[model samples]
Structures are given as C-alpha cells and as structure tokens.
Target: MNMITMGIEEPWFKDPGVADMFGGKADVETIEGTNIVIRIDDEILDLVELTVARFHDDGEWVWDTPDAYGWTRNINGAKEAAMKHGWSEALLRLREVVPSEVVSVLDNIARMAAAAVRN
Candidate 1:
C-alpha cells in the first residue's frame, strides 16, 4: 500500500497533539516534497528517535575531534556504534512511547530518501 494509506489508518497519524513527536511538525509542502513517508507501516517514530540520537552522538564525536578525518571517522564510528548498540531497541522504545500514527507520518521520510537516491 501507499505511504498515506498505511499511515492514515495508524493511531498516531490521527492525533494532532502527538504530531511533532514523530517529526510531523514540519510543513506539508516540505514533507510531501521529500516523500519520506514511503513505507507507512514502518516504525518511523522509532527511526526518528534513533536518527536524533545518531546526530547527537555523531555531533559530539565531531566536536571532540580536531581534523577532517576525525569528523568522518568519528561520525561514521558513532553511526556504527549506534546501529550496533541496539538501534532496534531504540526504535522499539520510541514506538512504545510515541503514537503509531505519528510513526506512520515519520515513515514518509524513507520515500524522500529514496527519491533523493534515484535522482
């Protein structure tokens, strides 16, 4: 099914209060422009939480380093560690806390990334 179809029916998608929890606060045009919501059934909120943590950890690594190589290596290492250290658990916990509908809205991000790759 299409991203909208999958997400619209989810519990998180309907609630306005929890919209921002899954990165749903962004404008419709931006969200639609990226088409990030490809897999509506996917755990988008969980992924988003993981992404935030990824950036936070990677940023810290970069801040700690001095050279360009440090930027790349540390960022890469942080990502590797994040994924290795239980990305699944992070996402699962995010899902447990955030609403399912918000998660659906967040899944659209995958579509956006896919579109970027194809281009």
Candidate 2:
C-alpha cells in the first residue's frame, strides 16, 4: 500500500496525539522523506539504500571502505549487526512512538523508494 493509505489504515496515525509527537503535524509526506542512518562501528550506512540494494540483487550489498569489505562478507550477518548497533537515542525515542515492526517498515519504505525510481 502507498504511504498515505498505510498512514490512514494504521491506528497510530489516527490518534490525535500522533500529531503532537511529530511537532504538531503528522504529514505522511514529511514522514516519507525521513532518512535512517545505520552505523556499524565507525562506518555509516544508509538504511534505506541498504534495504533497497539488498532486495535488488539476491541480497548482496557493497560498501566503499576497506573496513566495509569485512562487514559485507556475510550480508545477513552485517544486517543483523547493523540493526543491533544502529539504534540511536532518537530512534529509541521514536520506537516508543511507533510500533516495533521495524523490518516490515523498512521493507515498505524500500519498496516505495524503488517504485518512485521506476515511475
């Protein structure tokens, strides 16, 4: 489903207090542009880009840094590591506001990004 539809269907967005959580506005368009940065040790990774790339070619991901080479050696392992280490204080706070279905949420966002590119 599209983001607007997802927002409408999701009970969280329907709550009046949801707007206050997002600085008095719960715009789906604004949330659509949200970026999630994942850090693995000293390396920073784009969560959306990684999710999209992972599904694009049988789950293979590449990174530029020499240190990244080791991280990408086992793709699933790297993803698990990222999920474990990437939760920032802001994200932890966001988790309290949003549901815990992070994997599903990231997959949907990645799909939307890919569809946007195609159209």
Clash count per candidate: 11, 0
- TM-score result, candidate 2: 0.21
In candidate 2, what are the lDDT values of residues 8-118, reduced to their tens digit?
A: 111111223223333422332222111244433344423421110122233343221211222354445544444333334325544553444456678899999999999
**Would you list the C-alpha lDDT of every candidate in the order shown?**
0.33, 0.34
Give the TM-score (vs. native) of candidate 1: 0.23
Candidate 1 worst ten-residue window by lDDT: 62-71
lDDT tens string, model 1, 12-79?
12123323432442222211101112133454432321121112332333111011112224434544
Error of 1 at 101 (Å): 14
In the order shown, the candidates' Cα RMSDs to the true structure are 18.4, 21.9
